[model samples]
Target: MKNVITISRQYGSGGREIGKKLADKLGIPFYDNELINLAAKESGFCASVFENAENKATNSLLYSIAMGMNAYGNQELGFTNLSLDDRIYLAQSDVIRKVAQKGPCVIVGRCADYVLKDTPGVINVFIWADIDFRIKRVMESDNLTEAKVIERIQKIDKGRANYYNYHSSEKWGRAENYHLSLRSDFIGIDSCADCIKSYIEYANNK
Candidate 1:
């Protein structure tokens, strides 16, 4: 495939698994937590730092004001004045851009769709599942009690939503923000990938 596909998904939606399978089928590399390792190498920071800061927003208004200077051709403030989280995000953004430039691949999460928004031949997809389906999936996958599973799912989804909303202009998991939105409960993960492939083909042909 010549085009790249980016998958943004909910916590228990099997997004990573689906992306891997799709990429394997297409003979392309699959990126999920692998993005963290790449960023660590490129940014010279430990991978755990990116893991901890994943999907979190910086609360430093002053830093944003300072970084805003970079937007207006003023690089005078410099990164020393920014917070650790902002610095990490800047590094992560650089890594993401570089990865996209390398080749067509399947990228999972990390606001990749937004990072590569202007890149040619890209398809953005969002995966979501019904509450019952997600809860059951998490329970089976994690071997957690029902109560624990529900709590974990809610908290994780909230974190992802908050992170996406904070980082991007559009709201997370909203239909308008993604080129295609699929419910894993009805479609199944494999079929979801098939549907995405078909959509990509149609998009390219049209």
Candidate 2:
């Protein structure tokens, strides 16, 4: 069986970098924003549509309407008539599933854990860091001021939380939602990657 890893992370927590490195070490494909392009291609939507819908949840009323339409009506009339946000989400969800079916890989964000919840040999991880640590990291990496970094982090994390919560039954960044949760600030990015690698190895062995 192939082992797939899904990483949910706080903004500026180095989750993407760690996932890439881990995938490299494990000799597997790493997917992040690349999923957006793939979804765009697969769904025949423009890349900008996917980008706008990325990590964002649709409004509750629209989501309910979309679900009801999907459930009670023909997909061509129902799904095609839905909002762009819902369409993009559905497209991305399909893309995520198709990618997982191909084999083992490291998928960062996009609620991949929720997407593969029932799939065997799937390991979910969540990465977080203290505000201070995240702010410093974002500022350094993006060359932004502390205040701007904080704002950016808050906006992105909020979007992520909303997206995850809207799509799945589990709460975002909660330990119960994932198989493993690590504080990158506490152990450092490289060490966090190492820990995830060890966990994957152990999980595969079992």
Candidate 3:
């Protein structure tokens, strides 16, 4: 069976770029926003719903609690109730698994590393960069002011961490959670992809 490569990345850490480049180098499909589109199509849901839930977790614990309550005489009030984020994530997770079944691919974010954990020959990688490097990348890419860049970077990274940690039972961006943790700051994106390719080759041979 072809191997699967799942990449979990920090915000503004060039993870998506690295994944894309790696997929190109390896001649495989690159799944990032493509997952959102596929999920929306497969689930018959609006794309915006999946987009919104992309790296965010539900903050509505009260909603879940209320749904769990059966005190009301109204059955409809507590029946088949799941938070919108949960539904979207469930749908996306299903899609991720299906896509992985097709063959080798470079999957970016969306808890894909965890989603495919049980699959043999799956390689999980986490990409990170220094705070200053990430901030500069955010600023240059988004054309945001330094302050806004910092704020957005922090908020997005927190969302990613919370989403991954809540769903995966593992720490996001921690070295132990991944087979490889590469610093985009130390090596350029293409070089990073080359390194990952070599690692994949070696693992396949072993």
For each candidate in turn, the TM-score is: 0.87, 0.89, 0.88
| Higher-lDDT candidate of 2 and 3 | 2
* CA lDDT, candidate 3, residue 65: 54
lDDT of 2 by residue, 87-201 (tens): 7778898998999999999999988999899998889999998899999988988899998998788778877787777667578988998889999999899999899999988
lDDT scores for all predictions?
0.78, 0.83, 0.80
Displacement of residue 74 (Cα, Å) in model 1 is 7.6
What is the clash tally of candidate 1?
Answer: 0
- A best-first ranking of the candidates according to their lDDT comes to 2, 3, 1
RMSD of each: 3.4, 2.8, 4.5
The collision pairs in model 2 are none
Return the top candidate by TM-score. Answer: 2
Please give, for residues 1-206, the per-residue lDDT of candidate 3 as tens digits. Answer: 33689998888889999999999888899998989999999979999878857444433344335333332233245424555566676778889899889889989989998888888878999999999999989898889999999878776777777777666658787898888899988988888898888889888887
lDDT for each residue of candidate 1 in 1-206, tens digit (9 for 90 to 100): 44688899987888888888888877888887788888888979998998956544333344345334344232246665555666766777777788778887899988888878888878899999888988888899999999998877776777677556555657888898789999988979999888888888898788
TM-score, prediction 1: 0.87
